[model samples]
Target: MTSSTPQTLYRKIWDQHVVTTRDDGTALLWVDRHYAHEGSFHAFDQLAASGRKVRRPDLTVGVADHYVPTRDRAKGSAEPEIREMIRLLDANTAGSGIRLFGLDDPDQGIVHVVGPEQGLTQPGLLIVCGDSHTSTHGAFGCLAFGIGASEVAHVLATQTLWQKPAKTLRITVDGSLGPGVTAKDLILAIIAEVGADGAAGHVIEYAGSAITELSMEARMTVCNMSIEAGGRAGMIAPDETTIGWLKGRPAVPQGQAWDAAVAQWQTLKTDAGAEFDREVRIDGASIAPTVTWGVSPEHAEPVTGTVPDPAQAGDPGRAAAWEAALDYMGLAAGQALSDIRIDRVFIGSCTNARIEDLRSAARVLDGRTTVIPTMIVPGSSAVKRQAEDEGLDRVFTASGAEWLESGCSMCAATNGDMVPPGERCASTTNRNFRGRQGPGSRTHLMSPAMAAAAAVTGHITDVRRLGDVR
Candidate 1:
């Protein structure tokens, strides 16, 4: 049934997984991989009540993230409910014969981080999880996205999901990224150009020279925040960079099988002249080190720019929203971005907690100590080990930063890791929504280097402005 018509990478993957389609345009997609975390308890409960066992235990994995503590795991969580959540994940996964990466497992980490690290995420696979950051897996050219609790339950029972086709969007970033500009800054700038809901009812496919030049980690960082833009998911065409990174991963094919897999992956690119529902072009050189000034990621501005004035907004509805966000963020319109002081800093999350991110922050903190409180949480146990091996941990520790265990710490503030009320934080995690880190907490989202710079100066300082680290 293969057609000669030009097809996008997303369309190719989606078509491959269609189990069936209804008369109303809804299709049942076969789930290739499903990862469950602590928050999936409700799904498991639903499955239990339905009297159905997991159809494919081998295709399911349980990760103890979200509610898992980043510190003192041996003693478990102080809160009884949090402890029970972890325990329930263990019980459910064990009961269903599904592999569980518990808190004590050496491979334990955030589900999105662990998936690719373990090679469970692969090109052309249809992946899903209860967590919104499931889009992170799409970096490998997969059609991955988040699913709700009921969807999770259905997948657990049938290994299939009913979904409507989303419009395809190709966001091409041409040219090379300038010095100090990163994938985080690029994504922030894109979100700002198109408002928060600009990509609604669409799936984004990142392309062009700039995107191809980015490392697999940078691609993951970009795809990870697609949910923030109200997108169904985000994807990048598989290439040499992706194959090289997946070469020796434990869960990937091996020997001759690996060669065959790479051969098939090579054809995963979008055909020339493929028609997209929409298209956007961005000049990478024009992007600057970006940061969020207000409550939304769309409130991003360059480090050299000033806070936006609500009254200047052309649309009245947008102006009102800007006013409310400015009030909640406690910022004055037209104020210099660098003048904003931060009470603390966080450098970890599915978005920017990989070894490269750690290295970037370490470079900025080489000889400089942080002026304010700072915490560093790795994405996974493997990343933590790699950082320690490279002495990046020492670099962070030397800079007066607290180096903690690996998990989704401080990003979601679900496991007792939270910023004190009314405090401002420079964080590498995605999203700057009000109370995201904690109640009454203000979050300023930026790249790891930017956050490290803010930590050293106690203000939102640009990494490029720091004369020299050596």
Candidate 2:
């Protein structure tokens, strides 16, 4: 008889794709979607050496995201390394007969952004990418994660991967979020509570009142940072909100097929009697506007909290880390969050570059002149076009924020949008690790609204003070 215990969406997908169960309890999983970036070249090289062609080209999609210059697409033509990588991707995808969203394609942007916008990401499928932020796809209720280069080669050749099942963790955040609090802040608070390594080896399912109330874009932001907490994968069950977002996207099923697909998706939720291996509950109201004070995502505190004093830390090693962070950030212990001024503000990244994110930032910046350099990068060409059509771009530009072309610009320094050395920036990007934005540059991560508020105030200020959140 089949087991009757309710299973998570991740478990259900895993069971559906299992080719075999080994004596050791591991299952070989069949991948439904394989995503690759320019960094995936090594994987294809390995597959070529093994005399194996990509087994399921139709299931694979390639795009140039990481290592592609966001500031100048022309740089792709001028830089030999960037040009050759793009050429290699074009040739490889062409030879393998795989679908590709090339740099010039209107649909092309960051791989993670392109996937969901094109409706390629859906419920109950297994997705893998060569980049860690693959967890972003889990917003669609899929089991997705980043794989190593070697594993990428294996997926390319066989379209199947070996894996051991992971235990499930349920993180339920209840209550209402206070004004100006965002999914970015909620996830940052979770990381702060659990620490960076807290969810290691577990697949997390985020639920509860607050999460259910969030929009698809907010849910995506929360799931996108699962990697920061060391979770194997993170997901939210497919609900009406999710279905609404998938309505007319290209890759989504249409008409009767859509109906059938939705029917299947309806079952992709936790059963009433479902039990998780572990559970954590957070009260959303207690979480404040959070910002990272150190290199790791977990090193965050409420905006009202002062810079942590290393001498007061509970652990010796943590104290040393905090000391290092303070030194690199040029911040002193006990410094007020309000007093730590920022020189730059960046509102973009795969983490928080959606249209709603832009709207939130624009609302905060309306009728205000930025006190520092501010750049707003939309997540995709589509997002840029839509924002312009709505005159959101004008709102940002009029507020003294530089509206930029779509890409992962300023999210990382690789795109020639680095903050000047020793400058401090309030960024909406993930990862504030030492030198993440650029060598000797300091990054203070926040939601787009918070980033915009900081741009006007020139420091980390409470976003609630701006105006009505609604």
What TM-score, over all chains together, does every model reach? Answer: 0.99, 0.97
Give the alpha carbon lDDT tens digit for every residue of 1-470 in model 2.
26787767777888889999899989889999999877788998999998988888999999866656565565464557767877888888888998988877877778888899989999988999988888998988989999999999999998999999888899999997888899999999999988788999999999999999999999999999998999988999989999999889999999999999999999888877777899999999999989987888988999989999999989999899899989999999998887788999999888999899999998898888999999998888788888899999889989998897777777866646788889999999989988888888899989999999999999898888777665
In order, what lDDT does every prediction score? Answer: 0.93, 0.88
Model 1 TM:
0.99
RMSD for each of the candidates: 1.1, 1.5
lDDT of 1 by residue, 196-281 (tens): 89898999999989999999999999999888888899999999899999989999999998888888889898999899999999
Candidate 2 Cα misplacement greater than 4 A, ranges: 72-78
Q: Model 1: runs farther than 4 Å from truth?
A: 468-470
What range of 10 consecutive residues in model 2 has the weakest lDDT sum?
Answer: 70-79
Clashes of 1: 0
